[model samples]
Target: RRSKDIRFAFDRVFNEDATQEQVFAGTTKHLITSVLNGYNTTVFAYGATGCGKTHTISGTPDDPGIIFLTMRELFERIQATEEEMSTDLSISYLEVYNESICDLLLEDGGRGRSLALREDQNGVVVAGLSEHHPKTVREVMQLLLLGNKNRAMSPTCANAVSSRSHAVLQVNVRRRPRTASISSNVTVATMSIIDLAGSERASVTKNTGGRLLEG
Candidate 1:
């Protein structure tokens, strides 16, 4: 059923008053719990360029959004269960620009790298990105901040600021087998949070900067 809001001509789910924290709380409970069934989940934000997509994903350091909240909750759960089970956790963040993949961490000597995911009869492989090892929640948060800085952000009218490219955060989880005798029963899971490049209405933007050219 479609209800028309003639003023905007489109139905809107969230409005300006929505807080980043509120959004995070909703997603943390829903998405993080489904990670155990060999499934992958993505949270995407789409709106005109200059909209708050970037803010929605990676809000200012003082303000935390879904990405931060999700990471914290997920890792916190993992930590809580550590006493009874053995697990290995790894996490990494990457940026995609014009179809190119760049490493957010280890940039000192790393050249721009491209990442890919391909699967055949066996499984999926994210090319150009090796599995990252993240032990504590704090460590992952640090890497996220580093990655957020490396992302391409610019000013716009749709919002005060916006994201120009896609950003991806990947967390990999592997459970240690009860023992070598029961190693085959061990399970693995992965979760990805993607902050997408906003959908910009060129005319509304006035299209001056490269954004105009790209759009």
Candidate 2:
């Protein structure tokens, strides 16, 4: 066999020994500042099956991950500026499965209904998606847990309880001067955190029909 070389570049790279905190700091910490400054930000994890994407995005209670750390920092910054700025935080969770979008925050996890996407001045959005205003990090985490329970999951030969869809959590932030006049402008931004489904190979995963289609 002939040998070939390929080179790739990234903003940053992590080693296997990197802790969750280290990963978040290197990859996502700066986005918090952008969100606070009224700029949209997004962070997503992609990899092959059982590669720790889920763990990094949503770590266990004892070892909380990016979601928890980000929320905690966001709330802290907002609180620090509460005297001068009034801020509102709204969260929406959804899943993309089989090329269909479903609201994971709904009572029944939006079963039997495929949501439509529409474009507005703010860009693309999911119509009829529910948004919940969370006042504290704990509240935000509670919502995350609920959404996770509703997320699409299934067993696969590559890994049991594999996520079968892409999970997206959007945090919308609106802020305005606390003492601003009626004509004052408000700043709006969104921070989207996504846990993408792992890439699959049918030959290895042995997925069939729906699962294969999803992959």
lDDT per residue, candidate 2, 1-215, as tens digits? 99889889899988999998999899899999999889999999898779998999999999888899899989999999999999999999999999899999887899899899999998999999999999999999999888899888989988888998999999999999989997898999999999999886778789998888987
Per-residue error (Å), model 2, residue 107: 1.7
User: Candidate 2 — worst ten consecutive residues by lDDT sum?
Assistant: 198-207
Q: Cα deviation of 168 in candidate 1 (Å)?
A: 0.8
User: Cα RMSD (Å) between model 2 and the true structure?
Assistant: 1.3
> Taking the tens digit of each residue's C-alpha lDDT, what string does model 1 give over 117-208?
77854377556665567766667777777677777776666655667677778877776544446636656777787888767676765557
| Leading candidate by TM-score | 2
Q: Can you list the residue pairs that collide in candidate 2?
A: none
Clashing pairs in 1: 49-200, 50-159
